[model samples]
Target: MSKKPNIIVAEDEEYNFALIRIIFEKEGMNILWAKNGEEAIEILNKNETIDLILMDIKMPVMNGLDATRIIKKINNNIPVIALTAYALPEDRAICMDAGCDEFITKPINRADLIKTAYKWLDQ
Candidate 1:
């Protein structure tokens, strides 16, 4: 792949994070993994070339909403997609309110993940 897209995945659950990683790995997309929101912030601050972010709403240090807000404040162009288990309407609202570019329901389909990434990566 030429010029692989960079993806930041902020998920605290080890198994869930791994599952997400596996999916991205299969796509041969360059990805950076973060266990929690704070770590996600650190990665962003470190200046990684993240084309997009797949954020989990609930995390240890800082929740995905707060992290997304902060990241967008710093740079709103980076597309952030909420990838969480919370299927509630309010859950999606919170993420969108926090400036998430888009969202996908949890138990993310591998094909959907790739499709979403491709869609936003182009933008």
Candidate 2:
């Protein structure tokens, strides 16, 4: 990438958003926060430079899976990683089917977050 990667985090919880912001900032990634998937879609529409998305599966207004499906239609090239409390295999499969490129269970692992970000950013 020519510039530092910009990541959109679609998380409703205040603490969760803060955690992701801190972690992403430490890695020199620009971060954008969306309180729900609706806001996420708005951001995606307004900002074409976003490099990746860390999506929360459960949110008011619109859920991540639904958002991912629409987002993929708009721009399938942007990689979206689903982050949710649900660790079930079915949940992962559903996220992938919805257009998420990767899945990570919460409470977010710092190492995993950094590694996943780097892996996708490099790609």
Best by TM-score: 2
Give one digit per residue, the lDDT tens place, for model 1 in 74-123: 88889999987888898788889999988898787878888888899887
List of clashing residue pairs for candidate 2: none
- Backbone clash pairs for candidate 1 read none
Predicted structure 1, TM vs. truth: 0.92
For candidate 2, the TM-score is 0.97
Worst 10 residues of 2 by lDDT: 1-10
RMSD to the hidden true structure, all candidates: 1.4, 0.8
- CA deviation > 4 Å runs, candidate 1: none
lDDT against the true structure, each candidate: 0.86, 0.94
On the 0 to 100 scale, the lDDT of residue 27 in model 1 is: 80
